[model samples]
Target: MSSEQRVLHTPDPAERENLATFLSRALRLDQAAVVRLRKRGSSLVSAWVATGFETLAVRTITAELGVDDVTVGADTVLAGLRTGHPVDLGYSMDSAWRGALPPMDGFAHVDDVPARALVELAERGADLAREHGGVHGPPASLLDQSVLTVTGADDLEVQVPMRVVFALTAMDFIPHAGEKAEARRIQPTELVRVRATRTWLRLDARYGSVARRLGGGIPLSPS
Candidate 1:
């Protein structure tokens, strides 16, 4: 993953017109509407399809020199193009679809191994929380001057220290015993806010410890 952000360049009139025609047909629009095309990096293109009224639909289309490729991402981007309603293009669905994270700052790619590992860890965490009657803390946290080293297959590693916010919930109970009282009463819970500078993610290699516990066989050997 490169630290430098990808740039988007405005498409020329011919390019825009071609994309508009394609989008109009794909989206089943009655009128041939004008569309906006922005060059993403070197190969990917982002198209803003007009709804012909007030709003516009934005999607990332896989193209090389304004020529659309017959790929899953390109087809998905075309199919996803709509009118009137808003769609949230949260993260890139695959490598071919390079949807920009809005306000666009930087780019990072997560391969299958890491993605599966993360998912497995999450499931294990949830299971532990449910069985132990406790809540799991946030998986990732932002640190002012701290970095998290993520190691992947082939000894690939990166230090990501970006700012992020996460929420966590916890439950606690007070134990009380009285000769006159047969049952304990539940008390109202209060919220407490605290500030911290650092966070940690623990990992182990045991088959039923974390990742393997989820039955995904994601080899996440965190140290």
Candidate 2:
């Protein structure tokens, strides 16, 4: 992987002001604008302002560029777009991201695991749940939630609702609430045992989009 990346396009304060003005004027005509970045070769990038989805007015804003660090900015921008949140283009474009591997707190050494491997395990758990054919349930109550304790390399006891297990396992970091306010990296290990009182899974409302896209409704509650 390239150590550095470049940002092809980002809005500046003046550009934002211009956009706001344009939007105010264009709203009278029922039109909108979108900004896009087009990459050209390894060292060239261009920016374009399209009016109502037009595709021929993009211009190269920056000169031929060398490698630059832009991953965090790009990811933050994408996330903002995905969540329909406002983005501080200035900060995102100028700020530097922290190192890739930050310290992992709250988790035991066994929780140190590769993100890819963890995702794979979650996928496998989901597959198992599908094969078993069970009804989905709501999230477990905090006081009665299942717990998985790990010490070393041992057979994992998979007793929790497969959906919950899959969601938890798929997370890159698990955040904790309290005075400390820290997150822990999930370490991958085989030595673990799960104790779950519930046997059924729950389709979280958040997965509604996935269900809709898959042409299926959330599973009905078990009778």
Worst 10 residues of 2 by lDDT: 206-215
Q: Tell me the spans in candidate 1 whose CA falls farther than 4 Å from its real position.
A: 1-38, 41-43, 46-60, 63-80, 83-114, 125-156, 159-223
- Over the full model, what C-alpha lDDT does candidate 1 score relative to the true structure? 0.29
User: lDDT tens digits, residues 1-223, model 2?
Assistant: 2323332233344343332333332232223323333445654443322222111122233233223323223333343333333343333232221112111122222222233343455555445545653464222232123333333335432322223333333221222234321223323332222221122121111111000101112223321
**Backbone clashes, each candidate:** 0, 10
Q: What local distance difference test score does each model get? A: 0.29, 0.29
Which residue pairs come into collision in candidate 1?
Answer: none
Error of 1 at 65 (Å): 12
Task: Write down the TM-score of every candidate.
Answer: 0.22, 0.22
- Candidate 2 Cα misplacement greater than 4 A, ranges: 1-110, 135-148, 152-165, 168-223
Worst 10 residues of 1 by lDDT: 164-173
The count of backbone overlaps in candidate 1 is 0
Q: Compared to the true structure, candidate 1 yields what TM-score?
A: 0.22
